[model samples]
Target chain A: MQPVAPSLRRKPTVMSLLARFAWLPLCFVLVGCHIDMYDQPKYRPNRPSDFFEDGRSMRPPVENTVAMGSFEADSALFTGRLNGELAVDLPMELTADLLERGQTRYEAFCAPCHGLAGDGNGVIAYRGPLQVPTLHNDRLRTVAIGYYFDVITNGINRMYSYAHRIPPEDRWAVAAYVRALQLSQNVDADTLTAEERALLGGP
Target chain B: MSAQIFSRNANAILLVSIAAIVLLIVGIISALIGLYLSPWYTGVGDAIEQPVPFSHKHHVDQLMIDCRYCHSTVERVAHAGIPSTDTCMSCHSQIWTNSPLLQPVRDSYQTGEPVLWNRVYDLPDFVYFNHSVHVAKGIGCASCHGRIDQQHLTAKAQPLYMGWCLGCHRAPEEHIRPRDEVFNMAYEPQMMPIADRLALVQEYQIPVDGRLTHCYTCHR
Candidate 1:
């Protein structure tokens, strides 16, 4: 069957003209303007709001509730202390894997600031105003392994805290690595293993 | 008389309208698909303005400074952190203290306020990526960042879409490198033979499976 002629069809009225604009809104709709949860209403940290009584988005911890994973069973491992005194021994076994992990972590974290040899000559130290101390100093050599851990976890004078940067296990590994670095610098020929002594061109 | 006018050249008009409608529909569909897939929205290789005008091309390429010198916490933290104003003062305090190029940095130092750097590469809020994890797992900075040493003002080097992310996550062994080379921006994979590189991946213990391809690997 033939379609109706154009003249026979109804002419576009003001209503039809208005209906032609329906696609304008449909274009926006088709573009997917619906808000994903990613863009949902949110309070960023440090932003103040009238909704909260404190006018702060950041909330303080409850009076007595403990944080998850806050309870560390072994203070020696986490804080480098045993019986309220700095521990001399490592809490974990000294293995090649641990040292390898330590070396990688040290290169990534400390090498830029402390130098690979712990000689206080890292690129930042030589160039920056901050004076980094050597790990092989007489005082540091005498300090307990836990003392190093404490300084790294809490950050001593002129240093920032690595608590957020380094994990407890990695921190211990770093302490062990530092100990190894200290031992390497000031080796007594009398105390060397016979195999090691041979490598030093000794009889 | 009206019917005769309407009938005149009606076949030609119908054919033209039909063709025009088909072309419009095809164009719309193609445009929608292109918007989703194309690099136009990704802003790949487009230079972004930052507050300090710091140039990785100058620092990494010319000065030959290691990537970790500035982004020091990359291997230990989630974010490949921007160096602090104090970190900048380390060198610029003496060298270029009077230069106008470093005015913002000097201003930030004097006021004890952070120089708010304009971020070039941004992921969706839902995608939770950790720099430390990727660094430790043996993926080199070059794999995702492209040749950043060549960039004067950094831009998003890749599409950063879900499919683009999945492409690498699917076969990470292809991207994983030696741990020492993670911060080596100019490092090329072909430096070592293919067999040696593959062996390095296995030695590094990078999972050769879909563990990283899982949604939670990135989202969580």
Candidate 2:
């Protein structure tokens, strides 16, 4: 095609070009305003779901299905029982580190109700207007180590199950620490070394 | 004949119109940028109301409870697990059994429904953040959560802008603390000497080879 004269052909003036595309900024504004990417339809942790019956995005495990590597139902470590009776000792070796770990876990999970010294004087017990049993009592002091694990796992009258919070190994650790706490409060002065007796004062 | 058709003031009026248009564009852009950065848009410090008005200050600062007491899976998982209704009733069943403030919690426990807490510090869906990696790498909870233990009502402490993330990824040594001190809200990052901080970065095996800043590091 032959080219037309410059003036004869239509030319886009700046104003006309701008008028043609005036909605460009509006598009940018609208696109920027949408938060679809920030809040996608996909579920993240704890997001509520309308599709599920319980409205929870997460689902509970199937009934009676044991998880992998957790099938040891008969072991004293898992059941806190030896044959028909509660085991009187830990299934694993006790170390200072284990005691320290037990102390930390105890302070976090148990001390709130049982008292740090197992004297039933925790802040929750005091404010709870409830009488928590003292671990120093003769019955609890003489109870088998597995009894503590069972109590922690199954919970007693007013106490709820802590199985979800403290795992089996930690339960054993706490049992050992509870035994230590009993010994601490029930120790005889004659059993103490000269240095330890002095530390207790009243020479 | 056409030369004198327009008035003499038209030139000045045209110039004024151009300047006004330029100023308008600049003003609009600036206003939008300002809005984007504002607390209203970023949701920084705005405490979203929850079904129950749970106070971190009371539970953490007053009670001295460990962070792991509730957020038990923070050390092992990508998401810090929220406490179940049973976790609440663990203590509430003993104390505060009659308080109206805990009614939702009690109701949830009885009804087997989950308490719906308003989401705080929700990063964009595109971002993949792992709580375990951060904790394992010695990033303190306060480093990102900003003294959440002190906030009576949970709120967004950081704007969670990509650049803000990059600021830490670029120089992690400045923010890294001892692994034991990760949950200590009062821990000061500067308390540890620079050499020790650098040593910790090395000890934790945090990649200083620009991998932390890669696009896939967060976006994926």
Candidate 3:
């Protein structure tokens, strides 16, 4: 190893130690604020609130305030009601395409609780106390299509409302499909088309 | 001073100290890198310890039960909701009535207390994922969850990072299926004759442009 030059070999003086350690205090003061983006002042889901009277973070929508494009000009179509009673007929026209769309939506949404055949033996109903009522039954079969729409829009007994998930058009479609399922199961053989009748061995 | 600083045995000591410091820094960096890439941190293919061992393979593959049967809120809720104890007892009540494995489920049914299932595909708090939107958009469960029907114990099939999400958001056609076959696990895509597949994408009303690729689509 090379020997240090006489000039470089300085004595360890108190002043030198102070000069060498001058950056220590500056280091303490220079730690800039590191606010983690995730840990910032924010409200999480279902967090309680001091601002609301109810103390819930989720606030109820202002009463009677209509959302843009969601204004229900036709009360019958949105609510299935005409003068505080369930309407007899659907506000919208029923078509083959509408029935098909209804079938798809119904299968996805309703088939879990209401069986694919409307027998109320859906995969979920088989579980425990969550008994789903059958659409093919007399009480449901005689009810207006609008009644089904109403019940779907605003749930009944143990069944939660599906209003948010099922659009109005789809809700009407589902009601139509439920009617179709009811008819298909309860239909007389004489009412079938000749080809359909023959297919069912009813010729 | 004691024989002057850096004078006797100073060079050897200085070299050793410098080497030790370098080793320590390297060790720390490597450890961090290793930890970040490890399965413990990334949770890739790691089957979490759930309260009860529910096999998707048995229900989905063997019995051929639809996914929506148990995940009742997949098409409506933000998260694909877990099955209630009642849903399990629906089948297990008749079949596995007395099995020791299903004791917790039976107990949960007897008592209203929920089964605290540990989530496997956990994302950071920042990622706001909506299941209904994706399912409605015709994105199949397999797209993100991988072949869940084959998994005995459910695991995080993908990294589920922002980059992984963007890969599909950038081009969803490859993953898009006919809406009819969305629940069909056996269905596979054939984009080889590219025109037909591209047409199918349009037919399904799939949003393919910058609409889903935006950061706000998922983050906010």
Candidate 4:
């Protein structure tokens, strides 16, 4: 073999060694670039769709169509009316559990405008500077139980329909709670026993 | 020794180069870890811009509306449903009827077009999280979302890292609360005793057989 000069032998200097591993850092940096699995090419719930004209990933049910097993056979459960007039009685048997459910539902959906006491003193009513009708009034107190359900299902006056927020059964629950509230506020003092009066903290 | 081919500084350069390489590797790794955890990368506190600048503080805290009133399906389904325009109008039709801030909502209502909301807690597609199951098992809204009732604009509270999730899944008793308090934003996990939480884990039938930590639990 011909003798080669040390200069031409290509000594592995610090710069050469550094250059050898320079591509290593690039590997780490590039790892973050491929996030295909992170965000897949499929539509998630409410994800905007470019293909749809409205850009909604969730398509609305066809007009005048109801989902399977969702349709209520009892018209009164849905409309809060029977034979075209407001049903005076609850469609389902009223139980303590139902009343409790009603109380919670009312506090959540109705109490925001229809005060906790149903006197229309809810926080929203106060802030709305709008006259939300008191549920304790003569007409409201005398109205059929289904009347409250009807009003909630199809809003009266300034009230928008809460059908979207509160389901039909929940609307009935709120109605039942409204009745309970009316009864609570309208108790005749003379009818109470001394023990009951003592419990009520009233003379 | 006769030729003196190498310079004295060569050893110094070699030592410094070795130290520099070690430091470079350490520095790069540290930078990557730091960026991964940062709010900029993780979007932990980023408040996404919505067409309507709805203040959760105003609606949830000040107004005292229930979280379920708006996110209606949180207890019933996987997705904590965004309220429809009508849910907004249920109050807006009576209140804030003319605010310029609610113009997009009004337009959406009138046009029958959905208001495009920017998602805040966008988890990766591979992971399957069910809001109903967690809610039923006694995880509060604030557990993962933080004190959202206090946030003027909703922002991400958790980084939603797999390790953060496994931290709880591996031992859920550390975070579980009463089923009733699941909606209470102020309720803390520590408020309930460890014994009670363990009891709830049993009562709620939360699997403690390492099934929660299994690969298919979330990924599938």
| DockQ ranking from best candidate downward | 4, 2, 1, 3
Tens digit per residue, CA lDDT, model 4, A1-203: 34568878987999999999999999899888987998999988989999899999899988978767655645888889888899999988898888998997888888888889999999989998689888887998898998988988888888888876678888888898888999999999888888888988855
Clashing residue pairs for model 4? none
Residues A1-203, candidate 1: write the lDDT tens digits. Answer: 46879999998999999998978988887898555755435654334456877564557577765567754646698778898899898899999878887776676567766888999887666655657788888999998889978987887776756665577888888888888888888899889889999998867
Fnat values, candidates in order: 0.11, 0.70, 0.07, 0.70
| 1 or 4, greater by DockQ | 4
TM-score of every model? 0.65, 0.83, 0.60, 0.85
Better of 3 and 4 by DockQ: 4
The per-prediction CA RMSD against the true structure, in angstroms, equals 6.7, 5.1, 7.9, 4.6
**Quality of candidate 3 docking, DockQ:** 0.11
lDDT of each: 0.76, 0.89, 0.76, 0.89
Q: What ranking of all candidate models by lDDT puts the best one first?
A: 2, 4, 3, 1
Query: Candidate 3's residue-wise lDDT over B1-220, tens digit each?
Result: 3355457798999999999999999999999978877778888777888778888997788656778756766777786766667667645655557779888888888975556676576566677899987787667788888889998998988878677788878877777776667677777665335576677678777777789888788887
> In candidate 1, what are the lDDT values of residues B1-220, reduced to their tens digit?
2345567689999999999999999999999989876777768888888876778898777665677656767876677867767667656654566789899999988975556666677666677778888888778888889998998988878877788778767766567677778878877766777787778767877677768677788875
Please name the candidate that would achieve the greatest DockQ relative to the true structure. 4
lDDT-better candidate, 1 vs 2 = 2
Better of 3 and 4 by TM-score: 4
Going through the candidates in order, their DockQ values are 0.14, 0.42, 0.11, 0.48
For each candidate, what is chain B's TM-score?
0.83, 0.87, 0.79, 0.92
Error of 2 at B217 (Å): 2.3
